[model samples]
Every structure is written in C-alpha cells, then in structure tokens.
Target: MIIDNGKLNKQQRKAVETTEGPVLVLSGAGTGKTRVITDRIVYILENNLAQPWQILTLTFTNKAAYKISKEISISDTSFKILNSKELWMGTFHSICLRILRRNFEHIGLKQNFLIFGEDDQKSVLKHVITNLGLDIKEYNPFVWVDKISFEKDKGIQDKYSNKELNFDKIYTAYNAQLARLNGLDFGDLIIKVLELFQIAPDILEKYQKQFKYIMVDEFQDTNAAQMQLLQKLTGNNFNICCVGDDDQSIYS
Candidate 1:
C-alpha cells in the first residue's frame, strides 16, 4: 500500500503497517510515532482491512490526538476512515467516558453522569470519612484518596470487592457517596468501568467483539486499570497496537 512518505519516518511506517498482535512501537523522543500512527490507521482503512467503527484508537493527550488529526488531514492523498467532517480521536479518558456513559444504565449509572475532578473527589472523600467515623484530618482525606486511588489503579478493589483492604470502610463509604452524587473521578472512571465489566458480562461481550483493532498510545505508562482493560477487551488473537517511551513514566 502507498503512503505519503513525506508524512512518516521509517520507524513509524513499519509500526503502522505491521498487522500483528499487540504491536509496540518503542522509541525515544522525536521518532515520528504520531506519523506512523496516522499513516497506519489510514492504510488499514484504505486497504479495506477495517472500518471506522471496528477500530479503537487512543492517544496520551488530546493535543496528540489533535496533531494526528491535523497531520492526517494534510496528507489527504491517502485513505480516510471517517468522513472529512468526523473526528474519531482523543485521550484514553475521553474514549472511556464515551464508552462508560453509553453503557452506564447496564451498570446502574446515569447517561449524563458528571465527572468529578480532584477537588470534587476530595470533598466527597472528606464527607465519606466523617460518616464512617474516621478523622479526615489525622488520616488526611486528600492523602488517603491518593493512596487508595493508587491501589484501585493497580486493579485492586477496595473492601467493596476485596475484604482485606485496611481502609475498607472508608473506601466503601467513599464509593457510596460518589454514587449518591452521580459523579465519578478519573480513578473512579477506570475502577467503575472495571466493575461494570465484571458485573455486566453481556455489556462487556458486546464491546469486546465490536472493535476489531485496538491501538493504545504510551504503552509503558499503562496503569493496572488500563492493562486490565486491554486484557479484557482484546482476545488472545485480536489485533492490538501500542506505542510508548518507557523512561517517561513520572509518578502521579
């Protein structure tokens, strides 16, 4: 298949066109990872290998997704997946929010659920701790939230699912409060999605079979929630593509 050579470097070209299982484009900075990504996607579509709906692509940042869109828009000499009017790109969070919202009712959530940022999360945690007879000051609700969130990121459920968690009462209370408020933080989004997948197998099966190809950016920075999501979504033989630079993982 032909690609606009002026748009992509050698590494990007190879990684993009490689239709293998869990392809990882590993390199340091300035390696045209984005170029390869767009070209690869275009080639896949142009070659009639996959459709727009069958492909699931994610970038680390919305800016990155925007850049990919701009580059692909410029290289119009190649194939196009969506119409020129369409934009099927964004960060992991954006993609998951769409998926979660659409399948919310299956998991006991509202379609218009609000996503709580850090401040909202802390506020809710504060109240949950108070209700559970815990001192928010001594335990530090903010610090507790961050630490507890780390475990959730690692695919570890709180007392709600895993009984051995020391802060089970607090975590359970925190989740209860979030549900009452019709809100979820970034960590809750991942954790709830995981929870939904576990509780609602039918919903998971529908999505798992829908996207034939899954592309993930920044593989090295993948948290437990992301890894587990990928694991649950992709079959042993499904096409999975990941691009990342390992040394760039700074702690949250």
Candidate 2:
C-alpha cells in the first residue's frame, strides 16, 4: 500500500516516517501535532510494522482519545483492516482501569471492584477524618482529597507529611477504608496498575511483548505515575513516539 505524504511538511513527514526507536515531535498550537500522530500510525500500519492491536496510543483526556480514534478510523478508506477499536488507545486512567480489571486478582481486588468518584472519595475521607477524632471543620475532606491526590500523582503513598495535621494517619485510614469497600479512587488506578506490574512480572512481560509501538499525545502533561507506567511498559521495546510542546506544559 502506498502512503500519501502530500499533506505533510518536511518535519511532519519525518515524524510520520520514523517508526524505529524513540521519536519526539515538539510543536506548538495549529502546527499539526495531532495530524503527525495519526499519520504516523498510518505509516506504521501501511508499512506492515505492526498490527492494529500492537500499537498502543495514549492521550491525556477522553476527548483527545476519541479524536485520535476517529481520525485513524476515517483517515484512509483503503485500509479496511485498520479498525481503531482494535488498537489499545485511551486516556491514562482509562487504560490503567483496563489493566487493573484484567489483573484485579493479582492486586487483591475483585473483578467487579468499584471506582470511586470525587463525591465518593470525599465521603470516605470525611468518615476517616471523623473517626480519627479530628474536627471535619478544620480537617476538611475536600482539601484532604486534593492533598492525597497530589501526593499519589507524585507516586508517594503512606509517607505524606504536613505540619498542621496528622495527615499520615488520615492517609492510612483513608486507604484502609477504600480497601475495605473494595474501591479505588482515580489516583489508585495508575498506582495499582504499577503495583500489579511489579508483583506480576509475567503479566508485564505479556503486555511489553504485545505492544510493539507506543505513542503518547500531550506528553508534556504526564505526571510521575504516568511516566513510571510508560517506563515499565517500554522497558523491553523502546518504540515510542511522544509529541508535545514544552512551552505548552501545564505542569510548570
């Protein structure tokens, strides 16, 4: 199958054609960053580098994932075998949820475990704060929820510190409550998957071998947990392409 390069400029063409090793495409707004990503996938497919399922495409938001999926689906009519649904593509939390669901047993969780939303997490935190004999007015559940989430995003667990309140006790109790209810918050999703990979080397090997190529969109916005997850998956095969503008980074 002959791939078309008429729409791409020199840099975009290079980003699409470089399928071997790690490739990083830094671009600003309206510079065809998304186009480069979609076209790169097409180039890999048309060249017979990997099957549709072997390419792991990840984005930071569900909207971005949907856009990428839609672009790949309608990008070329000749590539009938290229079904975007078959590709492992989704947001970081969504992808982690998929991994955790399949390997729930390895992480001491049921297959039907619940994912707690913000309100549910706040409720759990409130209960923990009250049970610990702390005043909810002073130790606000809402504030604690954000605090815990920030720490988890940094890959820290049970070791958080603060001068004002006994956050360590609260963090421990909050996690214990979550485990009792067989639930995981959004932050737990990424860390739990990381935990699963650490305990189950065979499972990690299975995915590492399965995903021949990995592509990350908005790579500048990835947090520590997300970065670790990417590192673990790409440890064996480093065929990854990350496209993002450092100036557009939201994380400072």
Q: Best lDDT goes to which candidate?
A: 2
Tens digits of per-residue lDDT, candidate 1, 87-205, equal: 44667678788778778887678768899887887888888878777776776878876876776777744434434444777776777888888888788777777788889888878
- Badly placed stretches (over 4 Å) of model 1 are 1-3, 6-9, 78-81, 84-88, 156-166
Q: How many backbone clashes does candidate 2 have?
A: 0
lDDT of 1: 0.73
Model 2 regions more than 4 Å off: 1-3, 156-164
State which candidate has the highest TM-score: 2
Per-residue accuracy of model 2 over 147-248 as CA lDDT, tens digit each: 989878976344554545588789889999999999999999999988999899999999999999999999999998899899999986889999998998
TM-score, cand. 2 vs. native = 0.95
